[model samples]
Target: MKPQERSELIDALLDGAISEADFLRLEAELHVDEKARRDYYERLELTTLLEIQAEAEAADLEERIVPMPATGRRTAWFATAGIAAVILGAIALLSVVWAPDPAGGPLAAKIDSRLEPSATGFAVLTNQADAVWDSGGALTEGDLMPQGDLHLTSGVIQVEFFSGVTVILEGEADFTIHSPMEMSVRRGKLRARVPAPAKGFRIRTAEGELVDLGTEFGLDVTEQHSEVHVLDGEVEWSPKSEAMRRLAKGKAIRSGNGGGTVELSAQPGAFIDATGLEEKRAAVRASRRSAWLTHSRELRRDSRLLAYYPFDQPAHWNRTLTDESGSRLDGAIVAAQRSTDRFGFPAGALDFSPTGSRVRVNVPGEHRSLTFLCWVRIDSLDRWYNSLFLTDGHELGEPHWQIMDDGRLFFSVKKRDATKKQKDKQVFYSPAFWTPALSGRWLQIATTLDLDARKVTHYLNGKILSEEAIEDEYLVEIVRIGPASIGNWSDPSRDDPHFAVRNFNGSMDEFAIFGTALSATEIAELYENGKP
Candidate 1:
């Protein structure tokens, strides 16, 4: 605790409002927070100890009130002296006990010098290929089960469980394992290796849940969707809205971004450079997540010029990215990019229900005309889903939302005629496997579809990403639609899913989605003041 908090605890204890257990907790923090530690020592030495002595002496004034019998009176003097000797001996013993610091011991000293109970024993962030860690962070002994968090800033972190099972952490990772059967992926991505004699573990993400069955493989999870790549063992990717599919090594399934399951080989890198979507997953430092947020924000805000806002308000962000040097950031932000030249925030907040980002104001279901307009600054439009992302797709005939795995924004939709899209579409945009990468820099994205006309179109920064219709039965089914979700391109779980966390890294500002297709002038106006 901080010094102020610690002082309050002490005051509360002295006043009898707190119990002994409460005091012990505060005492533990005093050992951690330096200021609290020092203040406690000073108060004990200069004030409390002296004050208690005075009280004890005052209590001694009533000693004469005791009347002793003949034998008792004779014994009283000796008893008093004996008790005083006992007290002195006890004090001496305690002094000796407290004098031997752990730094002087053999094993105790060695361990103390090597290990520290920080977030993780080791880390490898995305920005650096080099690995870093504290000695205490690794499990030197048997199966080192972390009773706490092992931060994976960006990319992935792999752990070998005592049972010969392994677990891999995807970027922006934070999780707690309750046991082999239960765990929560507070954010980012994770892949667990389940050994025999175990039913595997239960993993939960911000999107949904997973129950593994002795699976040896990788799981890539972001705030947008979850991609499962089975390397060796068998596992099942289950979704609450859809049926569960059992997966074998080399096979993969996507159960996110509002659609149903799509099967693929779980192939190693294809979109590596763009989303770092490597075919084979690799290990990354736990601190890389922090670095990505830092850099991504800096790059984006420079593109926007901050006079206007992009994405949402400047909140709705909380996670972390720490550098090898231990510098940390809780939200996506640009440092010292505070020049007047910049016009928008890297990421912002909204003040509506659901309070989402990359916000679109619309009704859910089906609609005839739709438009999504948002402010954006781009590093590379060639990278997938730069500014805003939204999609309406389905698997095996159910409607869902689709999102880019990197947590950037992308655009997609269902073809109402359904059969046409299932046939004439590019494999990447087809019902079959193959995800697209939206490219360009600083382009505003505005996407829309006229359901009655069976058409689709996109506008980037202020240009077009694509405009076409694949035609599908599912597309025809969407009549009215939902509001444009801010901060995100799509929430697949909402309608369907990939991603690191619920928060995005790039800056997004002044977003809106309407029922009608907007012209290039209108799209550009979104970046200006009051352009509906």
Candidate 2:
């Protein structure tokens, strides 16, 4: 790699990027290149200076007396590097999935350059609208991160924007991450979410910037005074008054007294994925456009578990679409879907059914984490576990996440070992779907998981629907998906997918997933996109 390339490579490495293999390759190259080594040492010195500046700044920031925003959800942090537990499912049945609309929403980007498979996150993104997503652990110059329900394990995160800027996240941090366009560190310690713009990209922060093209990642800053986090990407991180750290993911950098910086630890290099690079970039754009102070409200309608997709766009038309009618609310005051027959009311709900044969995301690939959000209206009761999604792992752990026969939402995450499967059930409310105008109206459902957090959360129309946890650790190979029809369960002569009718009465919309967990801010963002 040329000197310029070496510098770029160093920035990515500092941001927690570059696999062990790649790190070794770079290290060997440096041994023979004295100039490269010299240049690296010089940069390292500058970063050290920046860290010194940050400590002083943090002390000064203490005088401000800032009020922090509520994290909303509590994360059950888990940090054991046990078996990866990531099973690679062959792309056999899911190979030829229906084409997703080429015009899917603008994707959010993850500026964190270092997202490893085991580095748990519970958030994701899709275009301008989505449930939640992780940063995908990539810190591309223009990468985007998914918004909504975000939670991180005990680790640091450095996010950058398209215009050469960055923001760093500290441990156990949780917040609704919007793009670098407009951001606020409601919770956790963020270096900065603002960056200087380069080319066509424009960054928004305390005071947005227009940076130059030649920029590196990880210009992080977190305000303890207010528990706010900021990421300055691309542009050279020369703080105006010296404040917090502006280094990469693992290392620590500060902003103050000429902007000092330093390496906090020397953990082993973790592997990274370059495949989902595009999706990560899109997250940046989406986050850039998100509003900073949006509040999310739960949307719960009591009716039937009818399939509902938020938009009437083309891609959504690809998911399994099923419906029901003359249905009554199984639990709530009314029903999730009222009967008068409003076919296209929600515009793009899954009245038809996204699948017919097997269940699971029609897309190929064995993803480590996933988020499933749905809008449902139900009216009938049937035998067995009525499921929204199932995989080869059924009643067994990793096989099913469903509304059980007992009118409760249950998920069997890890069925292999009794210990793996939560000994206690995370029995949550199975509020029958809600309908329009009716007491039991239609509502939205959002669910997510973060491997590191060792926890899961369920939401109903912005509000947390399930107050409990699903004992099973949801470890599955195949992904099954469907709107429990009149009768269908894997168990023959016993449990079957049940409902009032095949075509659900209510509308479903804005159902998607992310690599990480969704946050309240993100949920509110989704509501805005899918709101009437």
Best by lDDT: 1
Backbone collision tally, model 2? 176
Candidate 2 lowest-lDDT run of ten: 73-82
The CA lDDT of each predicted structure is 0.45, 0.38
The TM-score measured for candidate 1 stands at 0.27
C-alpha root-mean-square deviation, each candidate: 25.8, 28.0
| lDDT by residue (tens digit), candidate 1, 1-532 | 6567778786776556877887889866764467776776676576565563444344355645333334644655445555676788789888887677856766565445334442432221222222123222422112234566655455434555444445555556667666546667756555455777656566776555666777555666666776777766677777757776788778987766676667779654421221242222222322333343454354343322211223323333432211111111112232212111122123332221121333333334444556655544332222233324333223222122322333233434433333533541211121211112121123345565556666665554455555666355435444344433334444444322232113233444344445466666756544332211
Question: What would the TM-scores of all predictions be?
Answer: 0.27, 0.29
Which sections of candidate 2 miss by over 4 Å? Answer: 1-347, 352-368, 381-384, 392-399, 404-407, 417-440, 467-507
How big is the positional error of residue 48 in model 2, measured in Å on the Cα after superposition? 90
Against the true structure, candidate 2 reaches a TM-score of: 0.29
Query: 1-532, model 2: which lDDT tens digit per residue?
Result: 8777789777666667888886887786776577878877887787775664443344346666333222431121111111222122224324544234365522211112112232222222211112122444422111235456456544444555433444445545565544434344333543333323433232222211223233322222234222111222233233334442233333323333333333343221221112233344345434532321121112223122222222333332243322221122111111222222122232333332222222223222333444656555433223245555444323332424555433455544543444543342233454533221121234456666544455566666676655344344443443323222211233222223232122222234444444446666666556554432
